[model samples]
Structure formats: structure tokens, C-alpha cells
Target: MDYLRVAGGRVLRPDGRVERADVAVDRDEGTIRAVGAPDEVDDAVGEPPGEALDADGSLVIPGLVNAHTHVAMTLLRGYADDKPLDPWLREDIWPAEAELTPDDIEAGAELGVLEMIRSGTTAFADMYFAMDRVADVVDRAGLRARLGHGVVTVAKEDADARADVEESLAVARELDGAADGRIRTAFMPHSLTTVGEEYLREGVAGAREAGVPVHLHANETTDEVDPIVDERGERPIAYAESLDALGADDFFAHGVHVDDSEVDRLAEAGTAVVHCPASNMKLASGMAPVQRLREAGVTVALGTDGAASNNDLDVFDEMRDAAMLGKLAADDAAAVPASAVVEMATAGGADALGLPGGRIEAGAAADLAVVDLDAPHLTPVHDPVSHLAYAAHGSDVRHTVCDGEVLMRDREVLTLDAAAVRERAANAASDLVERVESA
Candidate 1:
């Protein structure tokens, strides 16, 4: 059989158990063929494998998923800081975004993809404009993604607003099955406050017809929620339900300010929420009731939001932040435990995005990350799961694999030229800042 074997590592099982195991992947099908002891994997495969990844001294976990992000915003990392969400968008982010060209999007996307690959993130959901360029990067970089064009119709001519909605639906329709089924698509309205109800209703209908899920920002801040409550006499989740925007397949970003009713509604609707702890804290957005959401059966995933707000695309840091913030928000040290955060980063993220590859069992998608435990920060090896939540950094990733393809091996990315991507993104960011300043 032609397969790729990841041998000699402690595999994190689906039941939160860690055991010494070897994983065999069907390279042709991009799925796991077996996950067990070396002899067991050899028995299942019935022959020697075609390739192998050295996993000694490493912990093999399902590839980390960044459930929500504006990946092309990597060019804006550290560009604007110390501001609330509304002002940050209006004063700095929006103006700079208006100046972005497709080339700039591609450059920034390449940089973000490189960072994700290096940091062991194999899949993500990206909401941004010029997403075709981002999809192109994902295609070449051997990563999985749910791609969408973010639509905002807050201040536009009716015709222009309608056109933006149409573009989002069109992009979703055209890109759903791209990248050999590694890429999915979503209908994305930027946010409740940033989009008109008419456009949202129309776009969501189109997306339902296209059989794609919807993604949006909701209840990110009290400022965002108060308007909906005051105008519609309902919370943002209820408002979203009114627009047919909440669905079992749909996922929302933030949900920071959601109350008990909103959380229950999300659970009842089977909608998922991606908690961007770093971005929320950076923008001073209210803390998400992650423990409550999870307790209410809402799928809680972790996201970096965007490099601009997160300052990096590192899911490891996000896991740590989510655990810390969840405890603080609930005032319970056991609110978000290491196991919970680990599951959120993996299975919850994949489930939220409606993508595959969150588990390391047979027949699952072959997406995995190998974390080296040889560092000083990871010493004593008391509990790998605990270390993953509190100590491990993205730099500790020794390898990243997606679709049975090794994107990074031994800290060197193979799918894209890391140095070249960095240089291009740096140049693009500089040019973009200059243009924004000149304009």
C-alpha cells in the first residue's frame, strides 16, 4: 500500500488519552488508514509504507484549526493597536483595507499561510475580501480552509451593497469544492451592525440555495449588541435567527457579549461560536462566556481573529489564552480545563467549520501536528495535555501535516518558500502603509 507513516510518537487519542502509537495515512485518499502500535499499523497496511515522518520525542495531535480569521490581514499585524473594535475598524483598519489590492492580499495570505504551517495549524476559516487570492495561497500551500468574501453594506449605494452580497454568494458558489475538496466556502456578512438586514436576508437565502454555510460576527461587544436590542427588541442571536442567518452548519465569530438567552438560542439552533480570546482582549471586547456556552451544548471553537488584532496566527497561544480567559470569565479555575481547550482547538474547530480532520482515528482526514517536547518550557513532561495548554508555543511544532501531505518537516516549511513569503509580505505591508498615509 502507498501510505505515509508517522511513527514513534505519543498520540493524543480522541478520548483525551495519550498513548504511544504510530499513524499510517493513505496518501492517495488523504485519510488515515490506521492508528496504533507500529506492528499494528504494519498489520493494517499489509505492507511497508511509502514514506515516514520521524515523530520521536514528539506528541502527535490533530492539526490545530483556526476556526475564524481574516488571514490576509497578516500584513496589518501590529499596524494598529490599543484601540476598541469600532474605532480600530473605522479609524485604522477600514481605511487601510480600502487601499488593499489583490497582490497585497496574496502576499499577506502567503505570509499568514507560512506562519500557520510553521505553527502546526493545518486548517482555518478566513473571512475577508480578495478571498480568491487567499484561496490560491491555500491551494498551493497544501492547507485546508473555509474561504469567504466578507460583505459589509453599512455605508454604500444600494446597487453597490447589492453587488457586494452577490459577490460573496458567487465566491461561495464557485469555490466550495476547490483545491481537490480541501477548500470549503461560506457566505459571510461582516457583522450584524456592519450589514443591512435586507442584504443579509437576501445573501443568506442565496447561500442556502447554494448549500453553503453562513459565517458572521455577532455580539462581539455590548456596543454591537445594544443597537440590535434597542432597535429590534431582541438580542443579536435572535436578530440573526430572524434573518435565517443561524443554522446548524453556520458558525459565528466572537459572541463575546452573548447572554444566557443568546447562548441557549445558539445551542438550540446548533450554531457554533468561535471565541477569539486574544482579539477580544486586545480590543477590550467583553469576555465570552465560554464555559456557559459549552455547558449549554454550544460548540465552542478557538480563533485568532486576524493577525492585525491577534498580532500572530498561532493557535497554541490561542488555546492558552482561551483557557486563561475562560477561567477568568467564569471565576472558576476549572471553567476551561486543559482537556477542554485542547478539544476546542481541535474537534470543536473542525466541527464549527464543517470540515474534516480533527481526530487521529482511522478514516479521518490525515491532518496532524507534531509537537516537540524537548524544550525547557516543556520539561518534566508531567502531563502533555497540561503542557499544551500552559507551556507549549507554536515554535515547538516540529511538523505539520494536512491531507496526508507534509507541509512542514523539522521546522522547515515545504509547501511555500518561507523567506520569500516573509519578504513579499514585508514589502507589501510597507507599500500599503505608504498608500494609506498618502491617501
Candidate 2:
């Protein structure tokens, strides 16, 4: 059997146990063939694997999933900072975005994809315009994603607003099975308040007909939620439900300001919430009641939101931030434990995005990250899980593998030229800012 082996590492099992194991991957099928002892994997494969990745002195964990992000915003990283969500988007982000070209999107997407590979994120959900270019980057970068065209219709003419909704649906339908099934598509409305109710209803209906899930920002801040509540006489989640936008398959970013009733509705609908702790803090968006949401049987995931607000796309940092912020929000140190945040970064994220590659078991998507535990910050690893949530950094990743393909090995990315991507993104960002300024 043609397979690749990840040899001699402590594997983080689905049940959270760490054990010495070797994982065999069926490269042809892009699935985990076996995950067990060295002899056990050999027995399962029926032959020695032709290729192997050294996992010695490392811990093999499922590749992180950035469930919600505007990846191409990597070009806008640090372009605008120290502002609230509404003003930040209106005053800086939207102006810069209006000046973006498809080429700029591609350059920025390559930069974001390169960062994700280097940092061990194998899958993410991106909601932004010019997503065809982002999808191309994902295909070439050997990553998984749920890509969508973000539609915002608040300030547009009726015809233009309808056209935006149609474009989102068209992009979703056209790109559903692209990249050999590694890329899925979603219908993304920019946010509950940023989109009109009629367009949202139309877009969600079209998405349902096309058999795609919906993603959006919801209840991110008091400014966002108060208007919906005041106008609709109900909460944002209820307003979403009224539009038929809430569903088992749908996921929302930032449920930061959601209350108990909204939490109940989310739990009942099986809708997932992607907590962006760093982004929330950066924008002064209220802390998400992550522990409360989880206690209500809601599936909670972690996201970096976008590099503009998050300043980075590192899921390890998200995990650490989620744990810390959750504890503060709940006023309990045990509110979000290491195990919980780690699971959120992996399984919860995959489940939220309706993608694969959050576990390392047989028949699961072969997405894995090897974290080198030999660093000074990680010395005397009392519990690897603890280290993952509290101490680990993206640079700790030694190897990143997705879909049975090695994207990065030994701290060097193999799929894309790191230097070239950075250079292109820098140039694009400079050009974009200049255009926005000149306009």
C-alpha cells in the first residue's frame, strides 16, 4: 500500500490521552490509514511506508482549524487598530477593502495561506469578496477551507444589493466541490446588521436550496446587537431565526453579546459559535460567554477573525486567548480548561465549518501538526495539553501535514515559497493603502 508514516511521536488521541504512536497515512486516498504503535501501523499497512516524517521529540496533534476569518485581510494586518468594531470597519477597513483588486486578494491570500501552513492551521473558513482567488491559493497550498463571498447590502441600491446576494450564491454553488473536495463553500452575509432582512432571507434561501451552510457575524458587540433588538423587538439570534438563517449547519462568528435566550436558541438549533477572543478584545467587543454557551450544549469553536483585528492568524494564540478570556468572563479559573480550548480549536472548528480534518484516527482526514516540545518555554512538560493551551506558540510547529501531504517540514514550508509570498503581500498592501489614501 502506498502510504506515508508519521513516526515516533506522542499522539493526542481523540479521547485526550497522549500515547506513543506512529500514524500511517494513505496519501493516495488522503486519509489516516492507521494510528497505533510502530508494529501495529506496519501490520495495518501490510508494508513499510515509502515516505516518513520524523516526529521524535514532538507531540502530534490534529491540525488546527481557524473556523472563521477574513484571510485576505492579511494584507491589512496592522493597517487599522485601536478602534471599536463598527468604526474600525466603517472608517478604515471598508475604505481599504473598496480599493482591493483580485490580484491584491490573491497576493494577500497566498501570504495568509503561507502563514497558516507554517503555524499548523490546515483548514479555515474565509468570508470575504474575491474568494475565487482565495480558493486558488487554498488548492495550491494544500489546505482545506470553506470559502464564501461575503455579502453586505446595507448601503447599496436595491438592484446592487440583490446582485451581491446572487453573487454570493453563485460563488458558493460554483466552488462547492473545487480542489478535489478539499474546498467547501458557504453563503456568507457579512453580518446580521450589515445586511438587510429581505436580502438575507433571499440569500439564506438560495443557500439552502444549493445545499450549503450559512456563516455570518452575529451579536459581536453591543452596537451590533442593540440595533437589531431595538428594530426587530428581538435579539439578533431570534432575528436570524426569523430570517431562516439559523440552522444546524450554520455557524456564526462572535456571539459576544448573546444572552441566555439567544444562547438557548443557538443550542436548540445546533448552530456553532466561533469565539474570537483576541479580535473581540482588540475591538473592545464584549467577551463571549464561551463557558455558558458550551454548557448549553452549543458547539463552540475558536477563530482568529481576521489579521486586521487579530493581528495574526495563529490558532495556538486563539486557543490560549480563549482559555484566558473564558475564565475571566465566567469569573472562574476552571471555566475553559486546556482540554476544552484544544478541542474547540480542532473538532469544534471542523464541525462548525462542516469540513474534515480535526482528528487523527482511521478514516479521518489526515491533517496533523507536530509541535516540538523541546523549547525552553515548553520544558518539563507536565501536561502536553496544558502546554498547548497556555504556553505553545505557532513557531513551535515542526511539521504541518494536511490531506496526507506535507505542507511544511522541519520549519520550512514546502508548498509555497515563503519569501515570495511575503514580498508579494507587502507590495500589494502598500499599493492598496496608497490607492485608498489617494481616493
Candidate 3:
């Protein structure tokens, strides 16, 4: 509740590099009023009457944006493990989610938001049901997000799916630009394997008309392709192109099986992919051809998928996997360098979501995460960016600020009560386990 002066640190600027500087977060306007050398702005705000956070020359980077996720599934993080995507959804996930009341969803989402804030994820995209409750919890947490009305179809021609589409639109209209521009809605049609072509087209049209981004699951697995192409005589990207939906506003979740032609088309069309590595590996979905896509000049972002799949919304863990997997998948030791990995988690993810964030500049949103440079693994830092993308864990994030509000400071949380939220989520997960077992 005081003026925040973060001094004596290495700040990651807008130019994809780091420099020595300090920042004063103007809580009144929820923006960064001044940034300069340690004392350059000290006199700008007469007397510095608020709390002063000592930076002590640590490294600061913009908070990460998780481009795709289902955070409410935090309750189901490890529920259905070691199963293929189809059986995992058919036998376990959907049934469990069906039993979840709106209250249950709110509790889980609250916990998920708390965890993400502490771990330096300032924003994320979520595709889930009961999004009204999700919005309520997100507003309470004081973070930024892109939420969606979740959809899945069992029939090729179900008019009821149209009603679900309407419901999602209603949610979007009510929640778009909520919480001081921290929350917006994207149209989510589940996936190609789950929804038919007509529904996907309808959803895409609605999103395009509404001037919002469309989030879809594409090429997540080869198993998902048989039904779609066999039924529609085209791959997912081709189907989207035929519908005139492949554009900068469309965000595809996974591209593990997108062919070379599709990558070329995606790069040319300016569509982006949100790679979810942990979920792909855990479900034994083939590794997404991220190296090829990047080489094709496609914009690539990283995500944790969902708690039900990867089981946690930890962006730091995802970055590490992406860095290593990108290198190994290319059979080269330099596919995604440290700087590239950092950009994927920050700026690249922002570009994917169509948000005005992912950089620490005077005119940009005040979204940042500060790490303790004194950590054992991060000592003797030859390159701060390298240390951040490789050595620094989520636990090392000492502070996280989004939209100029300090969500967490000095490894302590402020936006929500972490202890109480964890207790409620634990109770909810226990009930879920009992229900899943008895059923």
C-alpha cells in the first residue's frame, strides 16, 4: 500500500536485452511512472513515502504469459496419469469435470491463480467450463487472463452445440475488458477431434466478428487426425484455411503433427502455435515439430496445457523443457537458445495472445518478476538471461507484479491467501478422488 521503489537491479528492457536500472511502480495509476538508474527517479515522486523493496542488483524480467491452459483443472493435476489422450478424456477427465460444480471450479481456479502469481506467470489463456466462476476468481486474484467458453461435441450435427456457442458469447460479452482490462474472452471449440467442421467454423466466425482471438487444439496428436481428415477430407489447418479462419487472430494450442506444408502456410498466414511440451510428453503425444515451425518463420509460444494433462500451471518448468526439447528435436545443441526461450515465455507468448504486455518499458504494462541473484545455481552469472532460462527455478522468483500491482513480494504472496486457498483445494481434490474411485 506504499510507493514501490525497486532499485539496484538488472532490468530486462524492451530490446530483448538487460540493463542496470530501477523502477518506481505508481500504485495510484497502476502503472510504472518512472524507470532509470538507482537514484535517477528518486526525486520524481517527492519523498518516496511508500514501501521500498531493495533489489540489491538482482535480475528482473517481464512476467511470463502462459498462452494456453485450463487452470481450474488444478484439482485434477495428477488424477489420470499414464493414459493416452482419448482414454484419458473418455475414462477419466471429462467425467470428473462433469461432477464439478461451479463452486468447485471457482475454488480450484482461485488456487491455480495464486500458484501462478507466485511463480511469475502474470497472464494466461484458459479453456474451461463455468467460466463465469473462473472470471470471478481471476478478478479476485488481481491478475490478467484470456478465458474461453469450453466446448466438446459427440455428434457431427448437434444443434445443442450451437447453444453452447451462444453461452460462450454471452460470457465473453459480459467479461470482456473486465478487471481494468485484465480479463478477456476467446472462443474455444475444444478440438478438431471433439467438434465437427460446422461448429468450428461457427465458433471461428463468431470470434472473428467479435474482434477476439480464437483458441483451438490443432495437431495435438496423430490419433486426433484420423477422425477429422477421414470425415472432412482435410487436415486441421487445411480445414481452417478453407473456412477462411487461418489468420493472426487464431491461436492453435499444439502443432505436434502439423506437416511441412501446414507450417509454411501458417508462417505465411501469420498464425501462431502455443506449444504444450509437458502434456505432449506425458500423454505420449509425439513431440511437436517446433524446430521446423520456427525455421519456417512461424511465431511460437509455450504453455503448460492444463493441470489435468501436464498437471500444473508452472511456466518455468515449461520453458526448461522447451529449451532442451527444441535442441534435441533439431539434433542440434542450439535450436532454442537462452534468449529465445526467455522471449517465448515473455514477449512471444504476449504476441500469441494479442496482449499489450511482455516487456518492461515506460509505456508498457507493469508486469514483471524479480529473482534473487544469490541462488546457488545462479551464482557467477556470466549471462543473466542464460541463468534465468536454465538455472533459475520458479521458487527463485521473489516478487511478481502485474498491471502495476504487487501480487507477490520477496517470496511472499499478497493477491490471495495462499494457505487458505490450498486447504480448500485439498478438500475439493479429496472429494474428487472419492467420487472418481466410487464411480
Candidate 4:
């Protein structure tokens, strides 16, 4: 009979409407039990049980979902910049990553999860090394994640490449449904160009056999798309289809260079694309055709990619960047309106990841973010949705909840010691840089 109540707030509904309500949670079940006015919610609960969160004078929206990110890459934040994907990865990122230790991975992941919780993100999809370490962070932080080990098989001996592919499949099998069912898993093939055709087909087949979805980088830049077209005589999505990788359950990250034909293929296959607007802009990776894809019935979600590229894991920033970039990419002010970006960050992400928390409704997972609108910047509220998409920053988040558990309240994180995690991560980042330089 454990219960938690979020009282006296305006709850944002799934369809962009808001209403003054109190949301009640069955903490034992970790699902929302009721969402209505105080009296109605109280009546539905019958008796007050455990605790209540005062959401007075705030907006209660579903917790943000970050669909794609390399969480442990937080150690590389600001480590490399102003280079395109290949050069950046080859000269700076890959070399540095080759020096990462399990301990370093843990520290960076803890910091990333801490930032995400602080920013009101309750769920994320992460691809990186030492995924077991990442899963540990997600468990301790009390957030949800879809995690996987990224497999890169280029220029490797057959034995080594097979081992890498097997490692990805093994990690996916081992980690799925971990962390009290808060963690799911996917098979990650890095990208089309990085992993060879045989490995991609074998890995994807193994994933399908295990009933797991696949995730990968696709059509991220002209450089990535050009080679595939030159060799295969088809677009990236079409080549992905040839590998048997594109499916309703699969999602690709950073479809920044997808053409109209590729967009059509994505829509028809029911695959999703995670648009990392900040990462794309920072790396000059070109803008994703988000408006066109959505118009063609493609489900587009939002992500920050990683702290290294995005410089932050704030879905608020992603929302603003998506709206602004979508318009510029389409040459129309009406393209990718504020409401659409908001949906992409929340419901769109949930839909893409095949998870259940993204709207304030009964029987949904009790994941939510509380935004304090009492500040001067948020003053004279005309449209909350507009402010959320265009004006809000992650700092405005006052509380974050996931699975009926309060992860943060009053801007204070409860699940982990933020100050301690930052210190550890800083130390780890310094050590990693030294090791990379020495190597």
C-alpha cells in the first residue's frame, strides 16, 4: 500500500493540453494510479499512504527521454572539438578511448547519469564500452536506460571481429531486463561503414533471434553516406535494409544526411531516427530532415548524442535546437513547431525505445519532471508548451521522478551524491588524458 502523491500542479497531458491536477502513484507497483484534481485523486486513493511531493505552482510533465547517447563519453567532454566525425574519431576520440579503464568508464557514467537526473531526464538509450558499468550507474541512479556495447569490426582479424560481434550479442543478452526491469538492451553495430557486411548480418540475425532490437549510427554525414552509395549503389537506409537491420523495432542515431528516398524507406519500415541536433551542428554534420521525415509518418525522437559532442545531456537544449534547426533545414518558420519538439523529447522518445513513460496518465510508469515557472525568465506564461520547447533550460527542473521513486527534489538529487560523482569524474578525466598523451 505504499503511495506517493504529486500534488497541486498543472499536469501536461499527452496531447499538449494542461490541467490542474494531483497525480497519485502506487509506489509498490511503480505506476501512476490517478491524475486529477486534488479531491478526485484523493478519492481515488481512499487514504493517504506514505509521502507527498508538493508540486505547487509548477508544471508536471513526463520525464524526458534521451533516445541516443554514449553516456561514459562524459570523460571526453570538451576533449576534442571543431573536427568532423572521422577525423575527430580517428585523431582524438578513438585514441583517447583506447586508453579508458573500467574505473574511468564507471566514473564518467556516474557523472552522466547524475547530469541526466539533474536535468529531469528519467530514461535514456546508451551505447558505449563497459556497458555493465553503465548499467550499474543506471541502477544506483534509479533511472531507466536501454544499454548496449558498440561493436566496431573494421580492419580486424576474423577472430577478433567475431569476438567483437559476439561480445555485443552477449552483452545485449546479459543486460536485457537488468536493474529491476528498468534496463533494456539493444544490438549496436557502430555504423554501416565501421562494421563489415558479414558482421552486420550475423549480429543483426543474432539480435533478432534473441528478440532484441538493433540500434546504430546511420547517414550521420555526407562522408558516411557517400562511401556506402559508391560501393553498394544504394542509400544508407537501403543498405541497412540489405543487412536486414531496418525494422519497426530498430532505431538509427543521427540521420543527418538522409535523402528523400531514404526518408521514404525509413517511414515504410517503421524505423525511428534519433535526431541529435546539437551534435550535428557542432560537428558540421548537416541538419536532419526532421520535418520531412515526420510529414512522411516517421517517428523522430531527440537525443544529445554524448557529452563530448553535445557538451551537455539536457533534453531541454535538444528541444530548442531541434525546433530552431528544423525550421532552418526546411526553410519554413512553421516547420517543427514547439509542440512537435516537446513531443519528440517525451512521447516520441518513449515510442522509439518501446518504453511506457512519456505522458501524464493513469496506468503509465510514474516518471515525471517538475519545472519551476516562478522565475523571471519564465514569467508571463502564455503557453507552457512553447516555453518548454523554446525557453526552458535544464536548470529550471526542480524535481525528477522515475518508477514512483523521487530521484531529485527541489534541485537536490537524492539517488547519488552529485558533488562526489563530479570529483571522481574530474579525476578520471585528467588521468585518461594523461594516459592518452603518453600512448
Q: List clashing residue pairs in candidate 2.
A: none
* Candidate 3 local lDDT, 287-323, one digit each (tens): 7878788889888898998887887787888888888
Model 3 poorest 10 in a row by lDDT: 45-54
**Over 4 Å off, model 1:** none
The better-scoring model by lDDT among 2 and 4 is 2
TM-score of each: 0.99, 0.99, 0.95, 0.99
Q: What residue pairs are clashing in model 4? A: none
Q: lDDT per residue, candidate 1, 1-439, as tens digits? A: 5799999999999999999999999989999999999989888999888888999999999999999999999999999999999999999999999999999999999999999999999999999999889999999999999999999999899999999999999999999989999999999999999999999999999999999999999999999999999999999999999999999999999999988999999999999999999999999997999999999999999999999999999999999999999999999999999999999999999999999988999999999999999989899998999999999999999999999999999999999998899999999999999999999
- Per-residue lDDT of 1-439 in model 2, one digit per residue for the tens? 6799999999999999999999999999999999999999888889888889999989999999999999999999999999998889999999999999999999999999999998899999999989899999999999999999999998899999999999999999999999999999999999988999899999999999999999999999999888887888999999999889899999999999999999999999999999999999999998999999999999999999999999999999999999999999999998999999999999999999988889989999999999999999999989999999999999999999999999999999999999999999999999898899899
The lDDT leader among the candidates is: 1
Q: Find the 10 residues in a row with the least total lDDT in model 4.
A: 48-57
Residue by residue across 256-357, what tens digits does model 4's lDDT show? 998888899999999999999999999999999899999999999999998989999999999999999999999999999999999999999998998779
* Lowest lDDT 10-residue stretch of candidate 1: 42-51
